[model samples]
Target: MRQPLFVTALAATAIALAAAANLPEPSADIKAAVAASTRTPANLARDQYRHPAETLSFFGVKPTDTVVEIWPGGGWYTEILAPLTKGKGTYYAASPWPDGNKGVQNKQTADAATYGHVKFAAFPWAEGQPKVPDGTADVVLTFRNVHNWRMGYQRGGTDYSGEAFAQMFAMLKPGGTLGIVDHRLPESASDDREKSSGYIKVSTIRRLAEAAGFEFVGASEINANAKDTADWPKGVWTLPPSLSQKDVDREKYVAIGESDRMTLRFRKPR
Candidate 1:
């Protein structure tokens, strides 16, 4: 299906503006890694909707760069990132205290066993938590986790989203890329109400990143779903995968498919 004219124009403008930027190009090795046999059929089925290759390319990911993935729940992207960075660079899975959660623990163990040399970083959810070393990473990526981080803004007794962005900024080397993918709310949406809705305004996200001292690079509509109305009984999770409402209007939600997402890239100033 052809994209809407506005989206196409935005992409074209971004490409033209960044024409001189030495963005990383995908290689045969990265392609082979993505197509590796270790991936499950169920996970592979979501590729059409996710467009991992194009998204990763947009973020300027390379084989030999230190990358940190924040809140890798279930390690969906980890499955691809581990192999791609295995022999050359480094991959760190950062999450908030994995010890208590059985699922997170199991994922960490399985990742260690399946992909040797994978590292773990403790995401600071509490006071006095050790931070990832300063200026250490080449790229930092987060997917669909921004809303969750926003939920912690006050609930966690601290500004969670603010601190998280600051941490990601401190961890990256000067000029490193920060890639984010999250369900996008309309520009007019209320910021306070965004937590329960599981969607965020692109402007709000930009404000947080800029507060943490990042320069907005560009955005992509690779994960945009025109069918999504962003107004559902169960918010963004009403759509597929989460299907939070269970059997209620399952077909309708499934037809609408995933939530429309904003793919944004930011850079730490050199």
Candidate 2:
């Protein structure tokens, strides 16, 4: 009877340990950062659709990792990232400098007040200069900037996607991560449409990264939106926020909300 009881106790302990190993930990700090008052209500409202917490988790972001955000347009993610990485980690806004872009200037100013120490790295898009140093970043992230790079490629014949991706790869340490979130176009969409439409195929992006010497880690549906048909009148701009149509089926576009996006992760080989 005593031996049987001992065996049962051991089995229970083993099961408990297994469960604890698999249980998801609370991202309490990240949640608190997102809820911080520094973030505007309009940016906060998009949390339901953006799923920032889950998306960051999928990208394997750590509090102490050195992160570089490529073209942080309007600093939507910057608000969350700046606070989260305030103490230990470094946050670099790798964007165009000396271009007199209001959005970039506004973001840098807001970031200083919000984080106290946000580093700005200049990316000369036209000159194709490498903004970030080699083997420094733990993660390099870009959101909705690929189409713009493609345009630069078309206009300058510099293979902007290839050059930019190689620079990103060079900026990371071995085994470091590259996280990308961009508007997704259907697989059936023509490659040429990427210039006009604010969308790119997943396969095309994967190839770009692979060519730059990064391995495909995985992809997440955290940013996917079923409502997006990818064939809007003014492209992705037809969605909310932009609403380029302006009062033409305004309510209908509002119902559809933001464009569907692809969340992808890649890794530098160790």
**Which pairs clash (backbone N, Cα, C closer than 3 Å) in model 1?**
none
Which residue window of length 10 is worst by lDDT in model 2?
1-10
Q: Score each candidate by Cα lDDT.
A: 0.77, 0.77
Give the number of the best model, judged by TM-score: 1
TM-score of each: 0.84, 0.84
Q: How big is the positional error of residue 136 in model 1, measured in Å on the Cα after superposition?
A: 0.5
lDDT tens per residue, model 1, 1-270: 333454334334334433434434445555555565555556655765676666788888988999998888777787778778878999887777744223445655665655666677777545565446789999999999888878763356333788889889989999999999999998876776687788888998999999999999998877788888787887888998899999998998888888899999999999
Relative to the true structure, candidate 1 reaches a TM of: 0.84
Q: What is the lDDT of residue 42 in candidate 1?
A: 66
